[model samples]
Target: MRRVALLAVAAPLLLVACSGDSDKGITVRAAQVATVSEIVDAPATVTARAMATVTSPADGRVASLLVKDGEGVNAGTVLAVVDSPSAQQRLAQARQAAAATSTGAVRIPRVNLAGTQAQTDGAAAAAFAQSQAAIAQIPDPAARARAQTQLAASRAQYAATQAQARDAVRQFDAGLAGLGTALRSLTAAQGVQAQAAVAAAQATVAALTLRSPIKGTVQLGGTSAGASGNLSDLLGSLPGGGAGAAGAAGAAGAAGGAGTPAPSAAGGAAGAATPSLITPGALVGQGTAVATIIDVSALGLQADVDETDILLVKPGVRAKVELDAVPGATYEAAVAAVDLSPTTSSRGGVSYHVRLTLGAGRDTAGAVVATPRPGMSAVAHLLVRTARDAVAVRASAVVRVGSRNAVWVVQGGTARQRYVTVGTQGEDLVAILAGVRAGERVVVTGAERVHAGQKL
Candidate 1:
């Protein structure tokens, strides 16, 4: 009887020890109402609002390097001058063509028809007869009538020519050697072509004198628009008509594409050569980079958000930015745009470009931060999802119960599985919508070790 009684007391003590040990291995927290946010991180780059690139309009040698690199310039300011022999030659050719075609008035000599009038009249009659026969063959009555009228007019013109010739011969017979008949003047099309060629040539020469298209600092290199091919401009400079060549490649996207219409500051330059290379007499091709003007009045950012998180991001979404150069500073920004086109990330993951307008920022000391220059690297944490004052639990507490999410709640020393409708998920907290309640204790640290009705 004494042995059995000692066993009974020991069993209760062992049960208390087991419960204490189980509780020691797990951590539980009372659920409370809190704000939960889902942040999507993205890689970003700073860029300028606009950039202007000045290019060599023609293949030529750098005649004069006007402004130094890094010098601020105004729009229309002459940055450099290129001496293109080809452009000068084209101008000269255009000028000479214009001079030759100065007057579109043309005259054909009228031969004396004193002895030839009879022959000319006979030939005219024969031609009219033959033409009339052909006109008769036209089945359409309206067409035949039109042809007959045209044939009669032609015959009348021939007779007029004979009369003019006869008159000229009489004048010659009267001893007036300079008296002769004049034919109709030529077309004015030649004149128009001449003017067009001259204007185009002049424009081409003017382009060689590179001017700043925008007010910005002059970089060593620039970008250009693609091949300039104008049919009228081309035809105007022919032996009598064709004139100048086309200009190619527009200034593109980082500062410079496939990249962006407004490039990042680092991307716009094709290549920057040393100041010496661009000195007088250096040769460059048509559309070659001569200089780039960066407009940094407004700053923006481009970030590549992963495809998985892109759906959560939209215009006007709030974000916080951090730059490597401006350490300890947090920049406030909002999504200005989200690109429809996707770009492949370095890890081969699909991502999209998201643009944001950087707003005011503060350093750790709470002072207003200065604007970051273009081409700076940055990271943005986008507040894509948020839940305000919702019942929430530690993220570790929520466990995947197959298709649904659930949390282990401690009730009267027993753990119970409460299936939840999860909402906004933050880094460390998860919003529980349906199953979980505020003030309820949930197993957080060791949720995986808990079973239904498990003692805590």
Candidate 2:
């Protein structure tokens, strides 16, 4: 019984020894398992896709550029009109001349050179008659012999007459060929002139009526429409016309193939009330652009980065964009292009333009919900680091001395200082290269105070 009592007492003491120290100020928690990521931030700017300089076609006064910059336009829509009274008058005259000279108006067919050939034949005949008359004279005993000689001469003259007739026939043939060619050429020229006159008249009339060549928001400028206001509002409120309808349809159709038809005209108009091509009374000039209509159905982002960061960007690289205007929202984008040439800021600094195409991701959906503006500031994070299941520890927990990294690890009721190789680091963690293993206890607390083989 005494031996059993001694055994019981020894078991308690052994349990205490195995349990080590009691709970104290130091608290231990499991290291968080997470994938580490890093980002490089660069400043950027946004710009329009294209900018055009509108000019006038003819030398005329600034009759006015009806639309202001940033206005929308449509194809075949008249943007501006240049007042050219002289040009209009000239066109009218040309039209009249063309109508007079057109087919069925006045066409003349002259006799072919065959008639000229007939006159040459008559001349040849007269010369032959004179030769015969001369040969008939001359008769003496010596004259009689001479008369016989004269008769021979007349016969030779008759042969020459036959040769002349053949020459006349050849000349007539050539003259007829030339006449045919000339007639055809003249007819073609007259036809061209007639068509040109008609075209000139039509073009002159067209110049007077400036219409929208593209469907877009119109800005009143060069010439005012008697009222001044935001260009976008005016375009939205303008009446319907063929030009306007086409523009609206095009814009809506481009917004993803689902679009509503523009409102139709109600009152007196032929076939269909064509929407007004442009706002009525809007002033325009020769070749002056009146509107800048953009199809915002799909939107993308453009960024200007420093030359140093350009190399890191490539087409298809994944990126996240946070717009300054859209707080707490990020848009998913992909690298579309890396432009080597300078895109923005003409100043002495080196910069390149990078285009980011927004993708149909959650971030992009957020952008649509937030509706970021065109020029809004955005920060992009290009994913460059990728690693999986790497062992890591807080960088702060590992103290670097010279070329070696040291961390205190707990073992056998004591703290041990271990020198380790760190492969990578993060804001809160460092990858332990060779000195640590998963699920091992480390001195996260009291790390700075612990010494090698020190008792806890």
Candidate 3:
């Protein structure tokens, strides 16, 4: 009775296993003889490739805030205006100095060097003629003596003339060199003054108009320390102080003062350059970073990659990114860079920030086609490993025994369990390093149900 009962249960189980159900398959073909691309998937992000910050390059009073936040701006657009009358005045003074130096009176000294040379030359000629006459009057016996004396006198006169001419020439050349030197010195001084004028003018211009250096979105920030008001007065006045003195009024005004604008171009602006995107009445100051203009044309996705998986990522490797906020949309990308250093977030968690560059794929029709903003979550699949023309089996077909993995091979109507050393694999296929060959049948569908020596 017990045997009959066992047979009854066994028969139904056998029939059920042999029936045409999904679990009935017990044969496996060779793992597809194609190259299997191994991939690693992780989260990623989209961000601008370049970002610019607009700040006060000078310190002065804010006369006008030309742009507001969230507004798009182009390069060289005036964003704000600062008052710098003092700088303008200084520039005007410098310009006046330069003009005076340029148009200054010229002085020329009178020196008759040519007349002096002519007088010396005539004296020398008369002296030569007298010496020659003396030589001709000498007798034949005293001719030698007369010739020698005349020669001496003639040489002396010639030497005096040469000396006079040399002195005149030297004086003339020296005067010319001195005049040139003086003119050059004046010119150089004027040039220095002109440069100062230009600098002052540039400073005034810069103070008058705040411009954007790049095309992007705007931002805002606080006022400068000097422009904030006197700290002592502020402290003394606190909420209330002196009656109605200018000091008291000035102190109160300073306390409630709208912060000063950036300095003249000569000096950097003390206030922030108004970003077209920012609203008015925003406080800003010198050395304060007010706005960031981001270039969003080429998008980049930043992702945190596990240290273990980072080895598989290389620059230029293909990747598929899926944003959590945008459903049914996937962006094709490539590994732009792999950050070797791990950074800790505010939460004290360490992560490697990997940057992925998006490919040239656009979705023009969808309602959500608008570009994704920063802080969006994304998943990235990176190719890690691949195998070609190698034996593979479904992950389900692999079984673990002790420390080794085993799979059941069906050959000649018998089921045999064989150990395999695995390599790379995918969702449904595992690369077989040993114990299996291409085109050989293995249990794929009923991997969990099959055992060694089990009847077919």
Candidate 4:
């Protein structure tokens, strides 16, 4: 019975070995001579070379919008007008104070004793002296009496004149003192304060008018208060004075004043020129962005490279850029910059920003291609290393054996373990420096199942 059981097990084992599924063979591929390149691919974005945001200098209502979105504008172009009543009032007060202080007489008064009062006093003294001398020379009682009376009259008149001269001198001195005080006041701290007020008022006035700081296309920006018809449609209607129709309604809303809702929040008509965020009567605070100007003539690509591959990228390295917007077209580019600092992704991976400059390329007929716009999605392939006509094999065909690398070569339905010295390992291919020749079949998968000298 034991012998019978052994025979039964051996018969089943023999049949199982002859079955089609019993053969565990490995897949093999021949090594080929081709160019292998080590490249790092990263997502990129097309961006403008320069961009600027125009902001409100102070809190105020937007009185007028001079440029619409997508409109071409030059540097210093008027973008919008802000109506700041408070600032205007402040400026008016400052100007009034300046004018009041600047319009007064600035000349210094001169005080001297050579005036009519001094002349009159001198003449009176001389006359009185002469009269006294004549009286003393007179003789006879009647004549002397008459002369005495005349002398008395002359003395009284001289006394009155002297009093008048003293009064005149006092008045002249008082006037000089007053003039000096006035001259000192003009050059004193009050004068400097007036000048400062005027300068501040001028600056406030300038702050009310927003202007484009760069030459480029304008993009309207601000906090949206309410929904209007299409935002773009409202901007388009500005050149046709459609905003005036909305202004009438806004004025009605403004009549409610302070506590009432903003007029812009009460949606306007279908064709009004009021901006989605800022309208004619809308209030904006200082430093609020009013518009954006982007210089689109020159564009570049911004890519984020993984931390592991960042060291392989450097300035002036050649790159190939493919844009999603312009499908099937590849452009030549060069690395312009790389951020030394790294940034962390949401998933905790580290990355570094790399900037590239796009170059103009020609087509097969040598025609210049169209330039890509800003904000387009792009992919950049940075060439790290390249080997021309190199003996290369799939990376999976090589396995790490202790410290060195080895591959399983299959010949005549048998496997042989061979050591390979690899120069550069790419994403899918590895360049072999030795121990592997072109057109040799190497086992790529299932190498663990086969040993050296194992038959397939």
Candidate 2 global CA lDDT score: 0.43
TM-score of 1: 0.63
Residue-level lDDT of model 3, residues 314-339, one tens digit each, is 88888766778776776778887888
lDDT for each residue of candidate 2 in 249-282, tens digit (9 for 90 to 100): 1211111100111111111011111222234444
Q: How high a TM-score does candidate 2 get?
A: 0.41
Give the alpha carbon lDDT tens digit for every residue of 308-350 in model 1: 8888899999988999989899999899889898989978999
TM-score of 4: 0.56
Estimated TM-score per prediction?
0.63, 0.41, 0.49, 0.56
Ranking by TM-score: 1, 4, 3, 2
User: How many residue pairs clash in each candidate at the backbone level?
Assistant: 26, 35, 40, 0
Supply candidate 3's per-residue lDDT for 414: 67
* Candidate 4: clashing pairs of residues: none
**Model 4 Cα lDDT, one tens digit per residue, 190-229:** 3334333334334445545666656778767632332233
Q: Judged by lDDT against the true structure, how good is candidate 1?
A: 0.61
Off by more than 4 A, model 3: 1-30, 55-61, 66-78, 81-215, 219-281, 285-289, 344-351, 362-369, 388-390, 401-404, 445-452
* Better candidate number, 2 or 3, judged by TM-score: 3
What are the lDDT scores of the predictions, listed in order?
0.61, 0.43, 0.51, 0.58
